[model samples]
Target: MTPPMRLRRRVRFVFELARAVWWLTRIELGLRRNDLPALCAKLGIECDLRSAAPPATEYVVLPRRTRTTVLACAYAVARWPMGSTCLRRCLVLGRLLRSLEPVLRIGVRRDGELSVHSWLEIGGRTLDATSANYATLGSP
Candidate 1:
């Protein structure tokens, strides 16, 4: 790649990362202050509060390259100070990759104590490693 092109890509990546972090912050704050449905509404995600399956709404389909870039940014921001939980990560990723039809899943397990986990999936494939230990409760 040309020097200018490389620089442009880097700039775009940084911008995407910043945007992801901003959204993550917003989601974290919303989770802390409001209910799930309210947060989803605020983020412009149409969700069915009564269903465990992924949202069944059409979204603006993003290009595969753009979706990949956004996913990279989302993962990068997952290490931020607030310590991204799976739920937060899924929420941010789901928002960023809505066009790809990401599903946000929550599961629970008991290994002496109750543990809950969340993850994102697309096309029946999980974006993150999920423990076989947890029993799926449902998706949001």
Candidate 2:
């Protein structure tokens, strides 16, 4: 068996990764682009008080995206809610995602009448919204 010290290190690494995942998941729940940099900075500080290096800097610089594509295609048979609220939620979640995965790009745009959307993507994979050529709106 590995030494206790090595085992402890392994466990700690796993724990930190898990913590990162949890924080990102929460962002995926609800957050705004402007609200993310500070929120993620706070989260990183709390999660790793021992480290002097800051983590939030990376998230603050990522780009943004806007999309109104459908969500949960597999659940199409289940008929899920695809309303403005859902798209808005994705936008909020995109903010959190910024901090979690620095590589994931983001953008925001508005559609017809009072409609705004945000989304995340990496290597052409749609993380939040569906694949639809929604009308190109504006950005922030």
Candidate 3:
């Protein structure tokens, strides 16, 4: 018999949480120290790491369930004791949406305080919870 919707959602939540934890652990242990390209290679994901070009204006609509799963994964990963960085968040999100060819982006802002941030974009449109102020670095 089919499970109830609430039970299905809960199961999805748990799966997403486990997926997030696995990716976060792999990234932290295997890929965190490498440069952008190397990290992408190790993860078998593509991204933009350059700082040229304006943000893409096109947006793609992901299924509600997929979006929900990605959000849950992000939340779970970020809640870790040390907390997650933008790179970790984006990587986990990208892994979930790998078929979508999400472009992982690292941007920098150097106003008074220089800072770098990583985010994911799909079909040229930036994903939710991404910063708009940071300048685009590159993609793959």
Candidate 4:
């Protein structure tokens, strides 16, 4: 790519990262003080906490470049002193990829002790690791 083009792309990426961080902060605060539905509403995502299946409405898949940027931002935030949890990451990702109709899933597993995990799914495919092992509790 040309030098100017590369610079422009980098600038856009940084902007997106900042936006993702802002949304993450909002989501974290919302989770601490409000209920799930309220948080979803604030983020402009229609979530059905009772539903397990992905939304029936069709959605266009997010472009690979955008998906990579979103995931990178999530990872960056997760490395902070106040690290992001699985639920938080999924919530943020769901909000970021709302146009793609991401499904936020919570699941549990019995591995000597019970453990809960959360992940996001798009087009019926799980977006992160560890979800395959957990029995789904529900999706939002």
Candidate 5:
């Protein structure tokens, strides 16, 4: 790539990184304040609160390239402050693909130690690195 093109790409990446950081912070704050409903409302997204878990096989996934882009952006931007990548990345990816109607899922396992995880699923397919590790707690 030409020097100017490389510079432009770098600038675009930085801007996107900043936007992802802002969304991550915003989502974290919303959760901390117990204000996710309000946050989603503000973002013009309808929150689907369900007490039932759906079958994991019930989704028509987007194209492979789209999924790759979403995951790449999530990992690239949410790699910091390690150990909490799932939720933040989910939120970031959800915001990025709001039109896809990302389904946010929380899963818990308590055999040895109680652990909870959050992830976003699009078209029924989970969109996180650890998607297979957890059972969905409710509809996502």
Candidate 6:
């Protein structure tokens, strides 16, 4: 059987998915960088909140690639106010992004109300440059 610590690590990783979804939904929603990054910052915090206890040892819990959790955490901080609509979308899209890393883009209809917007990219440019239309601020 997996050790207790290993079990905690695995569980933490699963919830990490939830944290990622929440943040990504916010980012894809086009909520400004500072606010969104703030949310993403909470991914680790939120992950711990979701857990019964932290691991016996540091697990180095992280996504497979660079700044994945950071981006996700930033997203959560920015869009947590949007509630479950954004969250639901985040889960779906975050899963897609995980598989399509460096090549994922998820955009939504952007109305004046706080909305969710997502786009995928590689290196620096957009993998799919489609506009989420959260506001008229950004061109599709």
Clashing pairs in model 4, backbone N/Cα/C closer than 3 A:
none
TM-score ranking from best candidate downward: 3, 4, 1, 5, 2, 6
Give the TM-score (vs. native) of candidate 6.
0.26
Which window of ten consecutive residues has the lowest lDDT sum in model 4?
52-61
Off by over 4 Å in 5: 1-8, 44-49, 54-83
Q: After superposition, how far is residue 76 of candidate 1 from its true place, in Å?
A: 4.3
In model 1, the clashing pairs are none
Candidate 2 residues 53-130, lDDT tens each?
212221132243211111222122123233334333333343334444422222333455554333444333455443
10 residues in a row with least lDDT, candidate 3: 51-60
lDDT of each: 0.66, 0.36, 0.74, 0.71, 0.63, 0.41
Provide C-alpha RMSD values for all models, in order.
5.1, 13.5, 3.3, 4.2, 4.0, 14.3
Could you give me the TM-score of model 3 versus the true structure? 0.83
* Stretches of candidate 1 exceeding 4 Å from the true structure: 44-64, 67-76, 138-140
Model 5 C-alpha RMSD to native: 4.0
TM-scores of the models, in the given order?
Answer: 0.70, 0.28, 0.83, 0.78, 0.67, 0.26
lDDT of 4 by residue, 9-95 (tens): 778777777777887778878989999878877776655556665333333356876765676567656764567687777777788
Question: Which ten-residue region of model 6 has the weakest summed lDDT?
Answer: 45-54
- Candidate 4, overall lDDT? 0.71
Off by over 4 Å in 4: 46-48, 52-62, 138-140
Q: Of the candidates numbered 2 and 5, which has the greater lDDT value?
A: 5
lDDT of 5 by residue, 27-66 (tens): 7677677665566665444444454664244344666535
Q: Tell me the spans in candidate 6 whose CA falls farther than 4 Å from its real position.
A: 31-140
> Which candidate leads the pack in TM-score?
3
